[model samples]
Target: MDPTLAIPLLGGLSPAAFMRRHWQKKPCLIRQAIPGVKPPLSRTELFALAERDDVETRLMLQRQGAWELRHGPFTRRQIPALNQPGWTLLIQGLDLQVPAAHALLQQFRFVPEARLDDLMISYASDGGGVGAHLDSYDVFLLQVSGRRRWRVGPVKDATLVPDMPVKLLANFEPTEEWVLEPGDMLYLPPRWGHDGVAEGPDCMTCSIGFRTPTPTEMAREVLQRMIDALEAPEKEPHYRDPAQTATATPGLIPEALQTFTQKAVIAALNDSRSLACALGETLTEPKAIVWFEGGEALAPGQGLRLDMRSKMMYDADHVFINGESFRAAGRDARLMRQLADQRALSAQECAGLSPGARELVEEWALSGWMHGV
Candidate 1:
C-alpha cells in the first residue's frame, strides 16, 4: 500500500522515482516482478468462469492463415481441445472476480485510480497469439504460466490490415526480443508495438491496461455534465438585461446571454465538488459486461473495505463507488479519502465515522461494493 512495498520488486527504486522516470515513458522488463507469481485461476476455474453469461470472454483461432473470433458464455464443450494449435482465449477483468488477481493489481497503486484499468487473462495454445498490435493506452504484460516469446519495437507504421477482426499492424518490425518465464513482466507505454506467441502448450499472460481518454471524449463528458448542471433547477440563473439597445442585426446573440453562458461554464468548472464527483463516478463505472451480487446491509460499527471487484475513487469534496458519487465533508471526507487511498477503513477509523456516514457505508455494503473490515 506504500512505496516501501515496491522496493524489492523495483530493484530498490523509490515509488516516486519510478513514477517520475519510467512510468508511461518507456519500458521495463522486471524479472520475477512478483516472486512465485502463479495464475490466479487454474485452467478449469477459468473455463468455468467463461461459462457464465456475465463474464466477458473471447476466443480467437488462427489456422491455415485464416483468423476466426468468437464471443463467449461458452459451454465446456465449446472450448477447443488442448491438442489444437493457434487458438487463444481471453478473459477480461479477472481481477474483479479473483482475490489473488485483485491483490496483484493493488501493487500498481502508485498510478492514479482514474488511469488504472483491469487485469485481462489470456490462455493460449502452442503458437497462439493475437498478432502484432499497438495499444493507445499503457499496458503491463505479466507472464503467469508456461512460456511466451515476445517481440517488441517502436512502430513507425501504425497501419492495420485492411480486413481483419484484430487491429494488427501491417508493418511490424521487431527491435527487441525476449522469452518470458513465469513471474516475468514487461511494461510498455502507449503506441509501442508488441507481439507474443506461446512457446508451448498452456501459456497464460495477464495484461493490466491503463485508461486513455482522448481529448474529444473528455470534452464530451465534461460538456454533458455542464449541461446537466445548468438544467438543475436550484442552480439555474437566467440572463437579465434591464436596458438593452435594439440592434438592427437581430441575428446576433445577445451580449448578456453570451456573458451568462460563459459565466455559467466557468462556475461549473470552478465547482470543486461537482468536478470531483464527475471524475470519480466516471472512473469507477463498471465495465459494460460487469454486474454485482447484492447482499445484506452491514451492522453498525462494522468496518468497511472496498469489494475487490469494485472500483472506488475520491477527490477533495466527494467519493465515488461503482460509478456513483456522494457529496462528502468534514471527518467523513477525510475518512473517505483514506479509504480511497488505502482501499479500506480500519476498525478504529470506522468507529470514528458519523452516524450518517455509517448508514451510507451500510448501504454500500448491501450493494456488494464494500465489505466488513
Candidate 2:
C-alpha cells in the first residue's frame, strides 16, 4: 500500500498525511471512506458464525437499567429475534475466521502491523450498546450495517460505573456526535470516551482496534525472551569473583554479582539480532482464540502464501511467524520478507526461491500456515 496515495478509504487524505496529522493524536471522521461498501456478512451469516465452537463470541443484553454479559458458542435458535430490544452479539477476531473479513481488514494496511490488531463485529438491536465507555487502545469504528448514533469526546474523569458488567464511563461528556450509516467510519484515539446506541434493529459495526503495549508488558515480554535465549547452566556464563574477599554477611547479594547481572542484562538487550528476534516473535503471536486447519504440503516450484489467519512479520535479519523466530539471509531472506509484507508470493516468485527456502515454504504449507500459490 502506498502511504502517499489519497485513497477513498482514507476520505481523500493520504495515509501518510493522516498518520502525521491525526493518528493517535486526535479523532477523524471519514464519510463514505468505503464507497458503496456493504457488510461482509449478513445478520443471518453472523449468527451462523457465532454458533460455531471455533469462533469467539460474546452476548450482551441491557434491560431496565441492568446489563448482562455471556460467552458464546451459540446456536442460531439461541440468538434473540430481530424484534428483540437491547441485545448485542459480538464476535472477536472476525478477520482470522472469515476471508471477506480478513480482506476488509487489509484496507487499513496503512497502519503498522504492530499497532493493527483485529476486526471485531458487533451486532446490536434497537437502543442496544455496551454503554458509554473509553478504551485504552485506538479504534476505528466502521458502520457496516444499519445506523448507529455515536457521541464521543475526551473524558476528564475516566471512572467506571460501579457493579456494572461493562466498564461504562461514570460521567460521559460528549463534545461531538454523529449518526453513522453504512461505509461511514469514526476513528478514536486511545482513552477517548465514546458511546454508540443502535438507532434501529440489525445494526452491525466493525471495530478495527490497535494494540497498545504498556511499558511493563513490553519489559516483561523482552525479559522473558532474554531468559529463553540463555542456554543451560553449563553453557551459560557464571559470575566469577576469585579475587573478592568474603564479607561478614556473605549470604547477601554481592555488589560485584549485582554489577555483573546488570551488565549481563544490558548486554542481552544490546544484542541487535536478539532484540529484533524477540520483538518479531512477540508481534507475530496469534491471539489465544486463534487456531488453524492442517493442509497438504506445497508442490515443488509452487508459489507460496500465508494463511489469512496467520500473522507474520520480519526485521532485517530475522523472520517471525506465529510467535516463532528464524534467522534469515540473502536473496531467499528478501523473498521471505516480501512474502511477509505482501502476504503471498506469485508463481514466478516462488519458482525463484532457493531449494532450502522452497522446503521451508512446503513445511509452512503442511502446517496450514501457508498455501500453494
How high is the CA lDDT of each candidate model?
Answer: 0.85, 0.88
Q: Report the C-alpha lDDT of model 1 over 250-274, residue by residue, as the tens digit.
A: 9999988898889877977887766
Candidate 1 global TM-score: 0.90
How well does candidate 2 match the true structure in TM-score terms?
0.94
For residue 211, model 2's alpha carbon misses the true position, in angstroms, by 0.6
lDDT of model number 1: 0.85
Worst 10 residues of 1 by lDDT: 3-12
lDDT tens readout by residue for model 2, 130-226: 9999998989999998999999999999888999988999999999999999999999999999999999988999999998989999878876886
Q: Which residue runs of candidate 2 sit more than 4 Å off their true CA positions?
A: 232-237, 243-251
lDDT score at residue 288, model 1, on the 0-100 scale: 84
Clashing pairs in 2: none
